[model samples]
Target chain A: MSCLETIQSYSLRSIGIGERLLPRSDFTLCEQVVLIGSGMIWNVYFGLMALTTGFFLATAIALGKGSANPWLRKPAEWFIFLFRGSPLFIQFFFAYFLFLNLKGAYPFFDPFTAAWLGALIVLFLNTGAYSAQIFYGALQSIPKGEVEAADAYGLSGWSRFRRIVWPTMLRLAWPAYTNEAIFLFHATTLVYFSGFPAWQQRGDALYYASYFADKTFNPFVPYPILAGYFILLTLVIIGLFGLVNRRLNRHLPANARSKMKLRLNLIR
Target chain B: MFSYCSDPDTLERLWWLSCYLTTGVHFSFYLSFLKVIGILAVTAPVALAFGFAGAMSARSQILPVSWLGKAYIAIVRGVPDIAFFLFFVIALDQGFEWLRHQALCPDWTDPIRQGNDFLVCPQAKLPLGTAPQAVHQAYAFALAVMTFALVFGAFVANVIFGAMRAVPKAQLETAEAYGMSPRQTFWRILVPQMWVYALPGLSNLWQVLIKATPLLFLLGIEDVVYWARELGGTKTARFTAYPHGDWRMWYFLALLVFYLFMTWGSEKVLSRIMARLTRGQATTGGEAQRKGAPA
Candidate 1:
């Protein structure tokens, strides 16, 4: 089949939409690229949803941890510790099993058996814990003078936080937070490989790539396509985050604005 | 393991659980934790060695050699390491067998790639096919260790290279002015001071290494994750003694706790080490240590 025809057949193969069966034999370059590209849809889905939701949760966690009330601070501290200390791979497994057990009691949790809900939830919390730590560190690093200035102007509590503290925390934290976002996407590759089954071969990019590798018994072709897709995705993440980084630093002089470089902070 | 455990059906709930936890498979399940630890112990030093060499190469004056070292560091950071974990094992295995094919089975003429199949002569198979199960397991584990080392080594190289640059230029120049050779200055001034800078990144990489260990299951090794899934699956009464319902959640919870403890313990130890290393140095940690020390 032609490249366009191959794209048509395998474009949504990951979600079990278009193709009934994957190519059995006679593997072609087009088939590998198209199927893996289809799998990128899941990666983007997981990464985008997890990062977006985790952003709010992470902010809450950072604030909660910094609060003087032990009720809020203790749980926030433990949540950050538990998630950050454990491996994301183990978190995925633990989450899958937890969700599966919960499914019996809560019928609403039936989708947890699928990769979409279960693994996404794990990634959500894992990234939340990571970024919470980053934001908390940034929160501590905020200049004392800024908070003092806000207090002098009679801005206290929520008003001061919303106006002064929050923006500065984000400005200082954006560089590290950008790294966290990039790694979150990279970690999405582990979802299909984790305990959560792909549910009808509808796995992530790594899933489809490994599938073709298994079929062809040649690791050369499929993996590079997956890597190339990921690199492209990483570049796009950098671009989008760079734009936000710019807006965050819009108030500052050009020399004072922190440049957004992709620093690969090691791991969770 | 109790003497009263001849018949599982007759045993009470607590006894049955005790016996179940001592089964041979359960023993292997417990051993897999050691395997995870073993992977960490073996891979860390090996990776550091690779990192040291990589950093040295990156600093080399030769053009092509430096390019290769730089590329190694860059490419590893750019891609998701899971891809390398999945890719390198098969690639290395095929590479080894192909090398053996060319060496020992010279008379054979079959193409290694026959359509969709990777066909090699019997003599070229890793572990020789007639070897014991232990040999196969060892070979697989060795492949995993190598893959881990290669990947983490790149990260370490980045840290070490930056650390080397972070050392004071004045210190090195003073050593040179004192009639020390370039090599002597590097060994005395650069290497000694670089550790303080490298420690933080290395600690971060250590945690990342711990987190990445579960991917061994994807590499087809029966690591802790594989055993957790296998042993925690629902077992019927007919299947074996002490059958239980789906208890995977509990198993994974234990795994989670195990990792949390590991990381917490490591952080404590690493901080202590950093304290000792930073003592009497010029940085903030060192200054604090100097102040905190009684005269």
Candidate 2:
């Protein structure tokens, strides 16, 4: 079949659109790229949604962790420790199985069985904990002078936080936050691999790549293609985050500005 | 395992609960925890060796050797590591088999990649088609270890590379001034001093490597996660002597507690090591320790 036909047929193969059965034979590069790219939609969706929501939740967690109140600090510390201490792989399994038992008890919560709800929830909480730790570290590192400056200007309570502390915390945390975002994108690939089943073969990039590998018995082709796509995606993420890092540090002198190099040392 | 455990249906109260908790599946659940540790014990040293080679290569004066090392570290870092894990196992297995195919069967050649199947001579089959099941499991475990090492090696190399750079240049210069060769200085001064700087990153890497052990399940290894799922899923009474309802939550909770304990224990050990390693060094930790000593 022609490349156009292959694209038309397998474009939405991941979400169960266009073609019912995946290309069983004569798998073309066009089919592999299109199907994998289509699958990447889910990766992007999971990463974007989780990172965006996790960002706000992480800020609250950071604040809670740094708060003097034991009620806030203790729970926040436990939450961070619980999620950060374990593997995301285990977290996915634990969450899925826990959700499964919950669904058994209450039939109304069936959505947790699917990746959309189940994996997303796990990713959200996991990233929240990780980013919270980063944010907490950053919040602690926020210069005392900034807060004192706010206080001297008659800024107190909400205004002081809004004007001084929050910005400084973000500026301090931006580099680490970028690393978290990159890993969150990578962690999305683990969703389908976990206990959560990919309904109708609607899965992520690695899932589709694995499908192709299983079919063709040729790991050389599909995996590199997937890797290439991910590398490109990562570059795009780095670029976007670099832009934001620049804005966050726009006021600083060039020598004082923190360079946002990709540090692969941190694990999710 | 009480004597009354033979008739679980008749038993009541805590006695029945106690027996149920110590079932055969629970034993497997407990064993799985050891498997996680086993992966760490094997993977850490291998990955460290690989990282050492990678760092040395990256620092090589030869352009291509350095470039190759840089590329290895960069590619792994750029992509999602899970992607590499999913890819490398199959790719490495196939590469091995393909080499074997060429070596074992010289006369027979009908295109290895014919259509969708990857057919090879029976003589070249990894673990052989008729090998014992244990051999197959061992082969799979080996691949999983390699995958973990290859992926984490890149990160470790990054850490080691930075640590090597962090070693003061003046120390190396002084060694060179004493007529010591570059290699001698690297071993005597650079390598020794680099550890103090590398300890922090290595400790963090150790924690990550510990946490990443669960990914073994995804690689098709019968690790802890696999056993937990297998043993904890809804089991009918017909299947075995001790059957229970869906108890995966409890199984996973056990896993969580196991991991928490492992991490906490690791932190304690790592801190002690760090303290020991920092002694007498020209670093902050060393200075603090010296000051705190009796005057």
The most accurate candidate by lDDT is 1
Clashes of 1: 0
lDDT (CA) per prediction: 0.91, 0.88
Error of 1 at A11 (Å): 1.3
Give model 1's TM-score versus the native structure.
0.98
List TM-scores for all candidates, in order. 0.98, 0.96
CAPRI band of model 2?
Answer: medium
Worst ten in a row by lDDT for model 2 chain A = A259-268
Per-residue lDDT of model 1, residues B168-253, tens digit only? 88898899999999889888889999999999989989988998888888888999999999999999989887778899999999
Question: Taking chain A by itself, what TM-score does each prediction score?
Answer: 0.97, 0.97
DockQ of each: 0.77, 0.71
Highest TM-score scorer? 1
DockQ, model 1, C-alpha based: 0.77
